[model samples]
Target: MIIKRTIRPLFSVIFVFAVAAVTLFFRAIVSGAGRDPYPDQNPFIISQTKHIPSLFNATLLKFSDVDLADASLRQNVEQLVDGDFLSFRTNRQRSFLSAGRYRLDIGVRNVRGSAMDLRSPEFHQLRLDFRRVLKDWWRQRRFDSEVLSKSNLVNALKGVKYKSCAVVGNSGILLKSNRGEEIDRHDFVIRLNNARIGGYERFVGSKTSLSFMNSNILHLCSRRGGCFCHPYGEKVPIMMYMSQPIHFLDYAVCNSSYKAPLMVTDPPLDMLCMRIVKYYSVKRFLKETGKELESWSGLHGGTEFHYSSGMQAIMLALGVCDKVSIYGFGKSDTAKHHYHTNQKTELSLHDYQAEYDLYEDLVNNPQAIPFISDKFKFPAVVIHR
Candidate 1:
């Protein structure tokens, strides 16, 4: 009886192993059949020339050589296990690459209006509408003629030429990441509002080239009864964006009280961000997913659409830096909202899912790497070089 029972259990184990082996064998056959024909041609690498150098000048795949958008989406869904989110990533990446190659020339006499410039006259005509938005923002700001003329909006980046940049978000996923050395090695580092590097420098890094914040945050951080009089460290430049008329008051305080250099985002630039959000809503969601975007006010419950400060930092980095690496941008179920604060925040105040989609898109970008992890993984995305 004992021998019979032992043999039965052994048979069960062997049967299970055989089934798994058969399954894997068929899976391998399917994958091999559908694999990319040109393994050496990577669409991720952005080059200016139409002719891609091959050992034999062989006909390699170009961005148009294959339906890359579909291929990337498939891979993202199979590997990341999120279909809709990966769809946004694939779409956004394609949109970015369609406009221009990955380099941003800081010293050029004139920067392109859109990172994705079009040679077609039709596109140029369409961009005039965007120009109107900028015009409206400029007229509304009503800056002192002298101040406006003397000040160069992007003068903070006048002498700066960064090969690499790290845009650090406030997400708690960075708590245990020992990536301080990796972050600091970059030529420039940017942080968002109220980002605390103290005591957590080993995890979040200590360098700050530029810091971005909106008016409401500035008011709270600088006011007499506010939580923090000076949240950011000295010598780090502040880039403040306008949200309300009250922001003007906060801007004044920051300029006067804070010894660090302060630059207000130009009306055109600020308006451009608004337009970008609108563009995403129209193209990314309504058309692709058949889903509509929901608007959320701040924690206080107001009535305007809000963009996360992390995304603002990312857009800014993409405009100036040659390559950008995003850290502490995504949140897992187990992680806290903010790394520095013990108190949890109401995430519903912003469109976090949509923003995460954008970050995922950037992660798949060849020039941009985003760090996302569930566990306390040391490095999130492996740098190929």
Candidate 2:
């Protein structure tokens, strides 16, 4: 009886240990089943079991047979699985129809596709209309053809390409930075609106390879005696985009006597700038606020809404320079709207925040930029505060 009692307790202890061991073994196996196979590889890879639902939803949204066949879509799905909420939302918007309906068609596509082609019939008509207006003004003024030909910017810059270019803006943040020497180091330096550089050369460089201005600035300059627009010296090239249709008269008068090239922006290039800025502005508006796209015009000036000169200069630099650096392109509450001017308020027309977002995207992921052709290779960009 003593041996029986002792063996019975021992068997009970053995049974308890056996049950515990089996429980732990199964728990370990189940835990390991959801673990990452290569924990050290690809930090963006989805590892947590909780995120499986999100992964599955994204996969379902993107996983059509056609999309599955596309290797790029597969890569995009992998990126989506890593939780890029903004991109995911943008994809959701694209994949869904109006009024909460869904569409099965899915593949990698730009949120807004490329701008109108320069060779398209619409562009040709635009060019013709622009030339007709300019020619009508030229006939009234009897402008010299020889002088106009001499000042042709496209001809002058036909073979010209810069290895490095700096596009300097007039934001008041420039006053806080001593980037003059750094700005001057570029192969070419482009200044906007002829911002004053005499007393502020330490903060803004004195070197000026090109001056980019809007038609309004030139019109104001035209009011002066001799139409004196040479803020950056007479030898510096000036590129201006038309702000009003009547500005061609100012161009005709100024280009006649200007020693350096004074050229209007190409019609196609102007259209391209317009489309790109609008796309960015709309995207930013939708992302930040609950307002609809139609409400954008009312928030921004209705007919007066226009891109700033700085944005267009950056776009021009992207096309002509191998490396582009942006300086003095931000705003602050304590700072003046322009470093050289007493104006303390920004104009309502420019969406500076959207432009800044564009600059960030340009620096971080140029491939994600919308309304630009894939055939155009984007230059390396850096933004200086």
Q: Could you tell me every candidate's TM-score relative to the true structure?
A: 0.51, 0.62
**Top lDDT: which candidate number?**
2
lDDT of 2: 0.65
In model 2, the number of clashes is 0
Residue-wise C-alpha lDDT for candidate 1, range 44-67, written one tens digit per residue = 222333444221112122211222
In terms of TM-score, the best-performing candidate is: 2
Can you tell me which runs of candidate 1 are displaced by over 4 Å? 1-137, 140-154, 225-229, 281-303, 343-346, 363-385
Candidate 2 lDDT tens digits, 153-252? 3254554678999999998899997999999999999999989999999998899999999987876675555667888899898998876544454465
For model 2, the stretches where C-alpha displacement exceeds 4 angstroms are 1-158
CA-RMSD of model 2:
17.6
